[model samples]
Target chain A: MADWDWDFTWEILPRLLAATVNTLLAAGIGYIIAMFLGLAFALAQRTPSNTLTMAVREAVEFIRSTPLVLQIFFVFYVGPEFGVVLSPWVAGMIAIGLHYAAYLSEVYRGGLENVPQGQWEAATSLNLSTARTYFRIIIPQALPPSIAGMGNYLVGIFKDTPVLSVIGVAELMQTANSIGSENYRYLEPYTMVGIIFLLISLPSAALLRSFDAWVRRKLGMN
Target chain B: MSYFEFLVAHGDLLLSGTLVTAMLAAVSIALAIVLALTAGLMRLAPAGPVRWVATVYIEFFRGTSLLVQLYWIFFVLPLFGLSLDKFTAGFIGVGMNLGAYGAELVRGAILSVPKGQWEAALAINMSPLTRMRRIILPQALVIMLPPWGNLLIELLKGTALVSLISVADLTFQAKQINATTFMSAKAFGTALIIYYVMARFIITPLMRWLERSMARKLGRA
Candidate 1:
């Protein structure tokens, strides 16, 4: 077994940290896409058209059932033949975002479902337009219950960012891989990447738990 | 080549790859269930070191990314003189990570069991071990079945990471075909369809049947 090398560890720290920003960026951008797309998906299922609902629901199930990495590959590779060429970063973001959006839509669906049927009836009784009912009355109520699941997926999206590295996105995992290969030392880089992930995710999870509680209280839901 | 031709040429390869994928998923689920049971029981134990240790293990595993864990085991463990073959490393990573999630489900399911059931068991003068083995676990098992089924699907998808570690799973075969033929559409599209079929057709039906059987066994059907 090779002895530990502190100097090599110190030398690689800066590069990994730089890549950390890119990892966060990818997660953040991907999350933004998922959050909006997920809402659309959740709402689509509740629409009046049977074909639209079934089609979207099946799409969500298919997406959720498959692996995220394969989706990343599909988007990156298969898009070209359809004349939808995209850079690695762009493709990675779409794939990751779409994958999580499927999961989040379920969360959204649950939240929306819990918004008592009376609320919908009340909105109709008020003669409010459909858009106004959803955006103004219904969504505000759905927001609190959705916060916890949304927060979980936020962390989930953060952790899955490493998969983007497979497509050469220059994120932390990719950076770690390149660093290890360049120096013929895989131990330090991979460990550092793990440490970085743990440090961020653990606290954010705790924070999210408290945030969920806080949102509930603010909405007076107990 | 057309997607049909691609499948005709490489159907056997694809099927064998899927067999490996299914095996990986099966072994990993078994491993995860064992770890989850152990750690889950630990987390619920009377407040002590075991509980604390379980808490730490769950948080540590759940917090870190899976790919990093796989890479560390596959790449870095050998530096410390513990060498695992690639398949062993693959399932261990996927199993242990999912096990953390499973542990929570276990904890939740157990807690969901009515406190009255425990009190009744105590009134019957059942030994602690027997009480848990007979009453608590049976009730908890029913409550946990649905979530466990979901985790099985997740476990199946997780086996895909093994391909990255160079395991010859379904995904590895797809990537291989894509590389050779540059037929990204036929290769990846076909792979996607197969995955969708396995998940939607096979796993979903299987889970539904299991859920129904468990509910019936529990007399809640």
Candidate 2:
């Protein structure tokens, strides 16, 4: 049986810390993509074109229904066959981005739906153009309620960055796996990964809650 | 090979894989429900220490990724002389992870019960247990069902990760078939479709039926 080794833990901590930076970078890029694409998906569902709405809705459902790792494999492996090759980083970002976009779109849909119909009527009465109404009025109202959900997914995408390791993205999980294989020590690296995640997620979750309330108060929506 | 030929060849393997996935999901969800109830109730406990334990459990589980948790259980535990089989590790890892999320849902639902209901139970001189079983839980069950539906689907998707630890689930079989045949689209595509059908058609409707029946039982249908 193996016992814990403090010296080895100290030695690998720097490498793990470097991988953590990559993990955060992956999460940040993925989240930026998800936020915009999610809005597109959410708004597409509300469009007057039945085909567009159906297509976007189906796409979201399909993505949500399937596993992220499978999608990652599909894109990374199968893309070259279709003449759209990508780097591991690009492929990982696209897969994770799209997967979470489906979820974030759902959050946006709920927020959009929560806005009263009378608000739209009021905007119409005020002679606001469709784009103006959406950008100026509806979006501000929609955002306060969606902040908490959006924040959850922010942390969610962060935690899920580990899946990119499967595609050899050099994120924290991949780094930890390699470290484990190299030293034949699983205990330290895995525990450190969990600790890193908890340390970030717990504080961010609390902050998001407070931020949610702050947004509501700031918008005077309550 | 044609898709039909592929199905004829590997259909049984995939089906058996599906069964394993289902069994993993079932065992994990069953265990999760038990854990969620205990922790949820403990979260409402008057004692600070008990509540703190429940909070820590939920936070630690919720904060980490399920894949990491599974790896820790499957890989790290053996170093400590606690060797678990793939199934047991998958079961515990997934169960505890989902339980943390479910416990929050459980706590939220119980708290959403109206204050009047508790007052009325008190007025009727019912015991706390009786009041909970009869009055509070029924309504909370209805409130809990929809989110539980989402969690169930999430748990079902999470079973795919168990493939990493050499569990013979659908994802593992997909990888195996793809490696041997080099049929990336055929193998992985089929796995994706199977997961879609199971989640969208089978498990989803079943969850809806459960939710509806619970609502009907409470005359809230």
Off by over 4 Å in 2: none
The digit string of per-residue lDDT tens for model 2 on A117-196 reads: 99999999999999999999999889888998999999999988998988899988999999999988889999999999
Leading candidate by lDDT: 2
Please report how far candidate 1 places residue A64 from its true position, in Å. 0.1
DockQ (C-alpha based) per candidate is 0.84, 0.78
Runs of candidate 1 exceeding 4 Å displacement: none
Model 2 per-residue lDDT tens digits across residues B1-221: 89999999989888989899989999999999999999998999899999999999999999999999999999998988899999999989999999999999999999999999999999999999999899998899899999998888888888888998989999889888878887778888999999899889988899999999998998888
Best by DockQ: 1
Tens-place lDDT digits, model 1, residues A102-191: 999999999999999999999999999999999999998888999899999999999999989878999999999999999999988999
